[model samples]
Target: MLLRLGSLLFALPALILLVLYGVEMSAVSDCTQLGGIYNFDTAECGTEAIPQTSYYLRHSGLVNGMMLLSVLGALAMSIGMLIKGMAQQAKS
Candidate 1:
């Protein structure tokens, strides 16, 4: 149980980060649709304006990759705990 809990505790942050990356992707893909402010005034109203490329997205990809690695590590730790628990049970 403790192993499962620990795995979940570590996994939670990675999951959150993954979700955040999805949101950031969505925002960057559709900035104007999401009510982003436009600097230039155009004759045609409601025209979608492109958002400037931000370094945040690039850094976010790196963060997402790290989070994925963390998730894998958590899974490995959980499996190790299970094995340890079984060995202890068998010894007793």
Candidate 2:
């Protein structure tokens, strides 16, 4: 029960984050398709390119780090649960 709860805790956040990330990516793609620059910090699409790099691109390390951590955390917890079940089966 504890393992299941732990897995849900990690998995839920990761799932929500992945959906949000996908939405952001889609917006960026739409902006690019329309020949506009999308500013992550400002959350604006503009015809004139900004001198500063994109908020998302500039802070890519941080963003990617978060996504990686959350996803990996969920995966690790799930794998642990699976292993525990397999071990129990093996014992029987």
Candidate 3:
């Protein structure tokens, strides 16, 4: 019961986060879309570029870190549950 409940808590949240991350990743915007210019030291693309960067690129490290941690946590819990089951089976 404990294993099932704990796995549900971890696995469900991890799955939800993974889906959300995928959705967020799909809606990505690139600087090139604004113009060929990355930044406007002078007139660029006939206007100031403002050197804008995508939200995902700016915070990708944090996002990836969170995703990695969640995945690892879910995997760890799942493996632990499996190991416990195997032990129980061996006992029987």
Candidate 4:
């Protein structure tokens, strides 16, 4: 029982991050639809933009970081859960 809870605790953060990143991706896609570019300084979309490629580039970095963390959490949860199951089976 404790192991189950521990595994779930490790997994919960990954689920939360996945949802947050999904929303962020949606917002970026919406911004791209306006036929304008996003300004990292103003955090808004505009025409005749100043080529703020850094906005997307920095965000991509953040997304990549988040993805990496989430994957680690998932792997931890998988291993923890697997160990818990085996321990229980051994006891039975």
lDDT of 4: 0.65
Considering every candidate listed, which one attains the maximal lDDT?
Answer: 2
Tens-place lDDT per residue, model 4, 46-90, is 775575454336567665665566566667767777887898999
**TM-score between candidate 1 and the true structure:** 0.42
**Model 2, range 5-80, lDDT digits (tens) per residue?**
5566566665766777788789989999999998777777888776756546766776666667666667777778
Every model's TM-score:
0.42, 0.55, 0.42, 0.49
Per-residue lDDT value at 3 in model 1: 66
Better of 2 and 3 by lDDT: 2
lDDT over C-alpha atoms for residue 14 of model 2: 58
Model 3 misplaced regions, further than 4 Å: 1-54
Comparing 3 with 4 on lDDT, the higher-scoring candidate is: 4
Q: In model 2, which residue pairs have backbone atoms overlapping below 3 Å?
A: none
lDDT of 3 by residue, 1-92 (tens): 54555566556655765686565444332434654444423323433446555545665776666666666667767777888989999999
Q: Which residue pairs show backbone clashes in model 3?
A: none
Q: Which stretches in model 2 have alpha-carbon errors above 4 Å?
A: 51-92
* Per-residue lDDT value at 40 in model 3: 26
lDDT of each structure?
Answer: 0.62, 0.74, 0.59, 0.65
Stretch of 10 with least lDDT, candidate 3: 38-47
**TM-score preference between candidates 2 and 3, better one:** 2
lDDT tens digits by residue: candidate 1, 47-80: 4664444435546676766667677767767787
